[model samples]
Target: MSTFFFSSSKAPSSVSSFPSFSTHSSSSPIHTFSESMMEGRIENAKPIITKWNLNSSSYTKAISVFGHNRKEAKELLKSVKDLFQAMHFLVSENSPSHKLVLAQTLMQIAMERLEHEFYQILSKHCDQLNPKSVSGQSSDESRNSDNKEASEDEDELKRAGKTITEEENVSQLAMSDLKAIAECMISSGYGKECIKIYKLIRKSIVDEGLHQLRIEQFKASRIQKMNWEVLEYMIKNWLSAVKIAVKTLFSGEKVLCDHVLSASDTIRESCFSHITEEGAMNLFRFPEFIAKGKKSQEKIFRQMELYEALTDLWPEIELIFNYDSTSAIKLQALSSQQKLGDSIQTILYEFESRIRKDLSKTPTIGGGIHPLTESAMCFICSLGDHSEILSEIFAEHPPRNSTITETNIGSSTSNHSSASPASVHLAWLIFVLLCKLDRKAEPCRKDLSLSYLFLANNLNFIIEKVRTSHLKDLFGEEWMSMHNKKLKQYALNYETVAWTKVFSSLPEKSSSPIPPDAAKECFRRFHAAFEEAYMKQTSWNVPDGKLRDELKISIAKKLVPAYREFFDTYIMMVNGDRNLEVLVRFGPAGLENYLSDLFLGTHILLSSSSSLSCSSSLGCIIR
Candidate 1:
């Protein structure tokens, strides 16, 4: 016999069919009539069930009543509600066992109709229910956008009502349709069917979204074997991908799942966890996978980049995957962060070891900035830029034995009391660099003054680096001031060794008269010592401009006035003597001009003449 599932309008007065039934006698002819009437009631539920069935011959396509026909959608929803009431009455009556079978079949048909409708709405409304839209619309808001009758019916079923949209946002309407069908099927005890379809479809959306973002399911082994450029590219893609995935993709899925399956927390959590967990774990596990590869200075920056990404997105991750079933996603994210931190720590240790173990004997020509000084400071300054992130990492893995401060200055100059653990570690690394540089200077000691120049150059380079980069803030004012003083001391030591012979050639005080014979002797010694020091210093360089100028000015202040005094006091004594030019040499203005040519990082020749004279403002020129 044909059956007819009654829509809301055609539903018979048999709406009272869900009432508990009793007969005057336990076994009577009236009870037999009840069975026949119940059997008719069961048959009537089949036409709408069969014709509107998702797989029926007449409607094989996925045309959702919810999406295209609000009238049919409302009728289908009413049919399912009535079917559940019939199923309840059959269970309570315990008679009409065959009609109970028929009722079960019709209920299955109604469930199938609603299930198809649920799937159709979700599939066709992908644009409307996209991650961006779903995230902003709450379940209550979606329900509020439902048709007035549908909204009232859902309030009875779920009471999911809220004021979120002033206008008819299409996403809200789409979500509302999905929610209505979901509640209908779930209340009919076909939640598993509804959830199964949901997980399959939504999981694919998540997977496809990830693929579009260029995120791969990177295994540790696969990522390790990949070329670094390829790995680095993927990391950049992931860095961009993770924010969208966490904040939008998975987050929106969670919001939608929580709303559509609001009738059952257990079902929704299971549905959401199954749909997105695997993809999310894979997303977060990417850093851990990369971290499993070799640790080197080249890879450390990427690892820290990954660490920063995870740390930055952790709050959202926790809140989205905030279910017991979804805890593994959080665990995976945390695991990746820890592994990246470890990789960073290993690379730093390797960096430190390289500095400590650098025993290369090559000294930089011109006593300029050394290769080690440039490389080590460049690396340390880069680390300083990320010190805020590293501060937390260093808290977990602090430097070992950073307090060994038996430096040439006799104590640790860096004051790390107010510094972060990151700053402390960087300061310790710089200390190690200073010690290495100290050892490096030994090879230059053949020229004791050159050795001091080497120290001055390197220390000056270090101080300038600290001044210009993020390291300045991290190292603090005290660290910079202390290092500045050390650099000045090195310069002072260089000046003392280099200029002593020249200064010694002249009398301690330039004063009164002198005989031409003694004046000639004094001038001869002064010319030889002055030319020697100036020629030597010209070959060396102070790369920093400020330091170089200061050194030049300091030397000028000392030598110019004293020698001018010597020249003025003794000139007349020698002027009248025979071969007087032998006792007279450079004029005071010429001496000052010659000093300007010093520290040019190139040497100018000076003639070893019997006498030389001040030629011009540019200094004495050898002929």
Candidate 2:
């Protein structure tokens, strides 16, 4: 009941069988089937088989002529084609080794058929009678010539066919086959092989196909199925691999560390697809890139949507809420960067939309406004360009935050005209920005701080705009009163000056209360102050109206208090130093024994100096 498949180009002449290897290894007698012995039996049946075209009856007679007994001959009488086909089906379905052997057999048979066809064609082309000269010379010579020509023809055909096979390296398959094999491996649940295929696809191939392969790989590595660490590793490596791809695209070489700057513009564009938040976290750990400072950071912000995941808006508000001049300056520089500007604007837009949706869907608690919303609003305002939007959002409030103390929420709602949390954080950030602006920003100190003040002054503008009752009605009025009070106390009254003087009266101390440790701290604070003063002056010189005056006063007021406090704290710490006693007791000399070379050098120098002095004195006495 078995079937077989065969090519008509070749025919079996006898019922020949061969030995098969057993599973266990052993030295054993090898049996052989001799073609010479089959020749006689094949010739005997050829006439009858040819007449019948080797039907079942002819198969039986041919097998019997080959000297098999009745039962053995009956088994051999089965169609050869059917037997071969069945073997092929079994091998393909179950045995890789057998499949490989069958493949090789097919290739060899194809080669043999090609050789036979080439020889037949050559024989037809030749002159039969004269042989060498259109059937020339003797009969033996003509036969020899025909045989040589046929053999040469066979060799040429074999070489040509083999060349075609050799030309098809593993790489020469149509990309479709490659992709199918890769996907098949993946479907078979072989992740390692799938990754290997993906790696090869990306590196060994190019064009749009690589892009599709990468996308496939990306889908394969999604978060739900993968652990966080694995996902992180995969993304990071993908980024690095893509960078190499980018380099190959633009420059035809691998990217080196030193070459980063040269390819920065292109790499920024191409590698962005790989710049997931997870990947950015990986990049940040690279100290070399981080130290390049804001440019690199800004580039990451521009390339990836990382800020969405990282917007810890509330902590940031609390950090710069006090309007520290230094923090304000850093914030300003940050906002000014072109890339940062785009990112912050985008983040704000997304945040605003979210907040609007949330407010409509959810009601506020009695005293708690969701601080998350306020935090978002505060961050936007702090950027200093979105105040109009911020003011509008906070206008209609029983103060919209969940974390605000219940008692304070009432006071806050009543004092609407005073300044919203958003404005406060904004003002603080702006002040810090102005401070960071150094000499360049100093002239604008007044301008920058004044802008902040303007935001604060109109802080109640949101309240004035709203017409709702109760909390809403008090918005403008409450804010105006609080605003006026804050300005009088901090901005106009001698409070700033008086406070500065009081802080100044505090004792001063050496920056480094102990040797070495405080030395760096002292320099750091000094440099910070110097830079703040420098940038502020720089900013102030380019002034713009009342804003300029407002910023200058604020900066001066802030600097006096902050510096005086720094001095008071530093001095108190410094006055308690026992550094000199410690050094003189068991310090330099105690460690000198370990530094024999340094100790010797110092001794030699001192002796040389003393001898020089003695020599000079002796010479003077002689004279």
Candidate 3:
């Protein structure tokens, strides 16, 4: 009889035509006929639902249907599954309307009870269902909670009375108590009610988690109006919040959603999308607003940071919001990344333009490094530290007006492929800086030697900046080697122009001995040449200690030996003369002492770079 009732053909046409049919009044002319047909199944099912129903006064005490009353919860789900089967049979019998009504009413009551249980468990186990816990929950561990429920699903087949729907019973176990309830409600065709309860409760948890993280949706106009300090504070909060929102809070919800609604893909996707969509859109939309804010070199670091945080979490975002309905969230995230990249690229081009068009003409006194060189190098290095994200950004907007190519970039840098876009962009920025530094060095040209010294000082400063920062990797061995060779050439040119006259005033160390009169004239010429170069080069500045020592040593190696040999050969020729002391003013020792004083920069340069240090630390933290 049970087998005949389950086939679609057995269900009477009139009952199957409508979704649900119920008539509460039991006093009907054909009530006896309906009762005889059902064989007391409806009456037996009612007591089981009413007894274990969450609202029943006996089961009250806010106890979990699945937590404290595991035995009763098992019976409740089994009874609900069985009642649904009996309803199909009642529809098939061409029974009286009252019996059909009673079966539908009993399913409604069971649905309400399950709905209550679902809400209670979600409300009670928020911590357990939180992202950190939910995502951390191993599938193996969730299976343990459903051990009893699985047996009961199998046990239904062996029951002596009416058999339940055989709709692929959950033989394998990897479901929690909540998941079991969800599957039971869903399979019985009460899934809408279960899904409604879940969406309402879980959305609040996602919203509240974002609230605690201080993430909020802000309009572009409002963000634009904010001072950079205020905007920076929000960017920092976002950096911290985006990770938790994706990895912890939303992730936890996704795992719990997938587990509970595993029985139906469409239902889980609907529920998860409805729960996380708005909050996620709000979270990702923030960076676009920030990108829309006032553009300045100062803001680029924070903007790049916002871009990177979203980029870093992209995989998790795609996995969690992996549904057509939630594609808006993914699109919003992708949109923000593009906006930030565009803004950063715009600012970078502007920065490059500024370096190219700089109008500063004032030279560093004594030809030390120009201020433009310091500021530009500092800003460019800060950008270089974010090379991973910057590469992505630069790829979309291939650095504008860029003439720098692969041979100039990080072929030798570890962790970077040859001719990477970021490497080329950084190298291009540095090349722009070098051109500007050359213009800044031009004012010292009247004294041709001072011009070379200026070029050498700025080039050395640029090299050190690259070596110390991430730019070292971007502008690889080739760039480093090229610049180092140019710096040496500049140093050599300066030595030639500055000291050629001095070297010519004395004969070579290999020159033949001369008459006393000729030797005295040589001493007089050397006196005039050496004093002039010393007076000028003494006040000149070279900030680098190693470069300063190298310059001094190079000068010493050339001048000291020649003069010492000249002085030793000619001193006796002029010793008896009364004006000898005046003519032979500097012995080789005196020349060495004065060489130490050269390039000291003491007369004109004072470094006050406290702010630059702070910015360098900021770059490290951003990277």
* Best candidate, TM-score: 1
lDDT of each: 0.74, 0.30, 0.75
Q: Per model, how many backbone clashes are there? A: 2, 55, 1
> In candidate 3, which residue ranges exceed 4 Å CA deviation?
1-39, 52-68, 130-175, 406-417, 508-517, 602-623
Cα lDDT of model 3 by residue, 1-623, tens digit = 21232232322123233345354344643344544545466767788777655445644525556665666777788777666656655655455657667777677667666766777777766655532322235533543334355466446435512432222111111135678888888777767767877898889888998999998767887887888888899999989999988988888778778777877878989999999998999999999998887789999988888888888899999988888999999999999999898899899989989888888887898889888889998988888888888888888877676555445432453235665677777777877788778888788789989999999999999899999998887777767898899999999999999999999999755546778898899989987887788878878989999999999999999899998888767776676787655666656776787788898765422112211111333221100
Models sorted by lDDT, best on top:
3, 1, 2
> Candidate 2: lDDT of 433?
27
Stretches off by above 4 angstroms in model 1 are 1-51, 54-62, 130-148, 151-168, 404-418, 510-515, 576-583, 608-623
Which parts of model 2 have CA positions greater than 4 angstroms off? 1-88, 91-104, 107-177, 180-198, 204-481, 485-623
Lowest-sum lDDT 10-residue window in model 2: 605-614
**Tens-digit lDDT track for model 1 on 128-170?**
6843344355655543443347655445334223443422245
Please list the Cα RMSD from the true structure of every candidate, rounded to 1 decimal place: 6.9, 28.8, 12.5
- Deviation of model 3 at 385, angstroms: 2.9
Better of 2 and 3 by TM-score: 3
Provide the lDDT at 544 for model 1: 80
RMSD of 2: 28.8
